[model samples]
Target: MIKLKELSRLYNINKTIVEYGLIELLPRQHRPFSYTLMRIVLFWVRTKHQHLSLPERLRLSLQSLGPIYIKLGQMLSTRRDLLPPIYADQLAYLQDNVPPFCGELAIKQIESSLGKTIDELFENFDATALASASIAQVHTATLREDNREVVIKVIRPEIEKTIQADIQLMKWLAQLMQRFLKDSERLRPVEVVYEYEKTIIDELDLMREGANAIQLRRNFLGSKLLYVPEIYSDYCTKNVLVMERIYGIPVSDIDALEAQGTDLKLLAERGVETFFTQVFRDSFFHADMHPGNVFVSYDHPEDPLWIGIDCGIVGTLNNEDKRYLAENFLAFFNRDYRQVAQLHIDSGWVPEDTPLEEFEFAIRAVCEPIFEKPLSEISFAAVLINLFNTARRYNMKVQPQLVLLQKTLLYIEGLGRQLYPQLDLWDTAKPFLEDWMKEQVSPTNLLKKLQQKAPFWLEKLPDLPELVYHNLASGKSLQKQQKQLIVSITKQQQKNSKSYFYIGIAATLTLVSTLAYLQTDKNLAMIAGIPGLFAWFLAWRHTNNE
Candidate 1:
């Protein structure tokens, strides 16, 4: 049963959907009803924003629907292939630019979370926000004890309750969609919401985000390609996080970078290299690399290093996924479309029943046009979209685990193009992929794998002989038991056969009794009926005993 608050939420959601003209997206059976009801409500509650484009309306609807819907829009923004360009473009605004809450409330929440007064905590704390996003806002501050420069990230006041309400509503909506919408399984709306729910709920804990930042910082320690800020653990909490403030040009600020005499081309290449290294080498990456979260170091004017922030959402791949991803990238670079198709089948990304030759052809057709020009001219996101579009026909399943990586790639490519439009991603990524592939098959890697497993093998070594003997004993016992079981099954089968014979005889006698009665032989009919009823009872008793 829905609560009163949830009902109210649903009413608002319906009104918003109706006002935004999204009723058209409703399933065929629901559209007419929703349209009529929404119009009736609209007469009382006027919408002044009717002049907005459909995409803009959608963006506003998601925004009005609250954080959960905004997050959904942000995720959808990455899938240009699945959505119209205008929608994707408009939805991109939800990434880090959502309207911030009041600074006074932020201070109160921070004080409450850390259990310290503002004056006691920071010698110089800026009430004005440095940046605001969906979950939290950051403010510049200096520690009172050491006067260390840092940024205080505070979760929005009472956000948890709002988030819970919106999330429950989304789950309800997803359920409705799956239950009523046509071909809804293809969308997997519930699964998508579940994924988003986990991601967002995880983000609600600033401590986890701080930990993600620390891990990423350690992963790229002493590396020139990327930089992660130091997290101040003592000042961090579930709702409030304090980290060393980072000063660098935002990655999207191309003109500012040019003004600083930054190496734009090198910057673009390093962005690609950083992504591949984070994915292939470490298997851990800062998944949310949108322009707002990425910055370029001013120190490395010649090298153009990257500084990553907001590690709330990170992505990691298992060993198998990493290996397959590396192989796929290498094959793609080499134009081995057949290998790509085979790898998909081997990885169970596509059905085993998919025709390899046809899949190869489809992949080739999608990829061939993109490679005709230099890598600099080709769009990495566009290539991925085309491949996905083609693969949809083959019933390729969505890998929800890779959704973060896909979003990261869009961010990286968009950043790369802004830094240097002529950036050759293939040129930057191919060598790294080749080296990774070589490492996978190397003797050293095999030795490492063996060494990693050596401890487990050693632990089991003493039990091996006993294990073998027990196995042999169990096998012998199993054979004897199997023979006995087979005999028992045979006896049961024989009994069932006898029961079935009785049932057949009963059915035949009943039919004969009916025919005799119809032919006016009453005595014969009575005799036949009595025997039929007796047989039926006997069969029933026999069947019950068996």
Candidate 2:
């Protein structure tokens, strides 16, 4: 029932559309009732009617729904193919910003989490937030002796309860959808909820995010590909995290980046290379590559370096997925749409019964025109969306793990476009994946396997002779045991036969003796017959027991 309210409330969302002037911008304008219906509903609760632009209404709606719906709006905004241009344009303006709880409340949260006063824990802490988001906010600080600048992040105390309540409502909606909605299973809404649950819950743990940052930092430790900030483990807790503060311009400031003399083209290409390195080489990547979370270093402005933040939503792929994905991308580059379609079926992304030839043609129809143009003109995210839609017709399944990877790719490409319009993503990323594939299947992997197996082989080496000898000894022992058991059963059967024969003989002798003594006593005949009958009954009883 609560689930119904949660879904119903979104449709009845007040204020946002009216405030932003989106009452006139409902999607189906060709149908005349669209605008009037939306306007009536949107203006329901306004004391003073206010006019807002299309984008403004979107931002207001996102803010009104709070974090969960804001996140959904953020995701939907990325889907350029799925949404109309006007709506997409407006949705792009949606922001995650919220009024932070309070400076004192944040202080209390940090102190309680660390079990120490702010001064004892840090030499200095800025009361004002450097940045704030849905679940947490960051504050700039410094150590007592080293005097190095660092950022401390703390989770809002009641944020978990709020998120949990929203999640429960989402789950309830998904369950209802499965029971009553057509094509709900096709979307796998329940599984999607569970995946969202895992992702958001994982983000609540600051230490886990700290470890994530550290591991991603290690992956590119000495490289210029991407820089993940160092995590200060000593200061990390479930609710609090302190990490190195970096200085770089936000990627959104194109004019500022240009003023710094950054080579926008090379920077765009490098971004693509960094993405490939993380996915193919490291198999772990910073999943949240949204524009707000990324920054460009001016130190080497001509050859700009990327500073990545927010390690909360990283993605990983298993070995099989990595291989198939690499192969699929390579095939797409070669314009072998047939190979691409086959790879999907072979990897179990599509059902086995999907006709290979038809699927291949469908893929070619969708991708051929896109790749015919330059890479910059090609949107990798759009291509993927098309493929997924086509595959859906053929009963394809979404690999939940790949969702983060896809999201990151879209962000990387979007950022790249903002930096340089001529960025060729396919050209930049192909070489790296090809090189990594060769290394994965190289002789070095075989040698590494042998090295790993050395200890087990050595342990068995000393017992080789004893094992062989035991096997030979046991072979004859089993045959001999079987023969002895068979012989014993045969002897038992012969004993039964001998006992019957003896009984028959005794009965015949008793009868003969009775005939010879018949003249002496008539009673002797009856006694002889009785002995015969007794022997026969005894023999019959013995046979029955057997």
Candidate 3:
């Protein structure tokens, strides 16, 4: 049963979409008659933002809708494989900023989660929110034990119900798009919505976020390029998180960084390096590197350090994903479009039957112009977008696992551009990838792998002789079974041959009887017919017996 509230909400969503002229963004040829009729019926809900571009309109519409939609837009912004560069660019501007919930309520929730009052946990706890986002708000406090400054993150009150309601509506709309819209399969509305749902729901669990932060902090411990805030797990819960508060210039604050004499070029290059290190070296990366979650340290303006927070979302690549990615990147660096296409095929990212020549040609066409200019002038993200767009024509589906990586790459590229436009991404990444690739196949790596397995091998040494004996006994038994099976098959073949011989004889007798019947002599016909009947009976009996 549909509630009145839900129905009203659905109508409002439709009204907002219509007023934003989102339907007009669709091609005229693709629009169904029913869509035209609906627009005609809702003629009074004219587009209010006629001056804005389609992409701008979309961003604004999602922003106006609410935090869930804003988060959806943010997630979609990373999907260059699914959307155009322009729309994705606009969506990247969608902020997660939302008004904070009540501080009193947050305190109560925290006390309930930790089973203690605010005073027992900390000193100088601020009731006012230090920062607020869609999922949670942060409150600054000093730990009672060591007087360490920390931020208490609490999930929004009743956010689950809001998320569920909005997600259900979004799912319903996605289904409508899947059913009614042309070429909607390429967009994959339902899958995108489901992905957004999972991301948002995961963000609701602050414990997972805290754990992710801890893992990331461990990975970057004593490192120069990036720093993750320490998670205070003792005071954390599913709905609340406590972590060391970091003081750094916001990565987006270019003016402040410049005022502080930050090495912008090195900073930009280091950003790319850090991203690759997380992906290839660590295999676990902070997927959300949006400006809000990233900060620049003040201590070293010459060699700036990055402070990462809000590790609710992270991406991991297995050995295969890392290998293929490194190879593909190196191939791109070398302008080897054929290798790129072949890698995609080998990785099963594209169809096996895809023509190598045609794919290579498509890639070269899309990538050749990119190399015409200096490498520093090129956009790695743009190159990826073109490659993905071309691959889509060849029926390449979007890789869901790579969505976070792709999004992070975009964030990195944007940061690079903002920090230092001439930072050559290729130059920074090529040697790293080449060196990593070499390390993967080196003798040292082989030794390391063997050493990793040494303990397991030693544990199984006592069983080796028993395993060998069992294997030999099983082989002998298998051979005996094979010989017996061959004998059985031979007996069946002989029986078939005997039955066939009887059938041939019966056929010959029947033919002779027909010939005799056609003759004028009745005694000859009678003698032949009796023999034919006896032969037929013998054949039937023999066949049935076999």
* Candidate 3 lDDT, 71-169, residue by residue in tens: 667766655545798997788676445567899999999999999999999999999998887678899999999999999999888878877878888
The segments of candidate 2 whose C-alpha lies over 4 angstroms from its true place after superposition are 1-25, 29-44, 47-49, 73-97, 180-182, 453-546
TM-scores of the models, in the order given: 0.82, 0.78, 0.84
lDDT of 1 by residue, 47-130 (tens): 657788878888889987877777667666655545777877788788777788888998898888889899999977888888
Number of the top candidate by TM-score?
Answer: 3
RMSD (CA, Å), candidate 1 to true, equals 5.0
Ranking by TM-score: 3, 1, 2
Which residue pairs does candidate 1 place in steric collision?
none
Error of 2 at 536 (Å): 37
Error of 2 at 10 (Å): 5.5
Better of 1 and 3 by TM-score: 3
- What TM-score does prediction 1 earn? 0.82
lDDT of 3: 0.85
Ranked candidates (lDDT, high to low)? 1, 3, 2
**What 10-residue stretch in candidate 1 is worst by lDDT?**
74-83
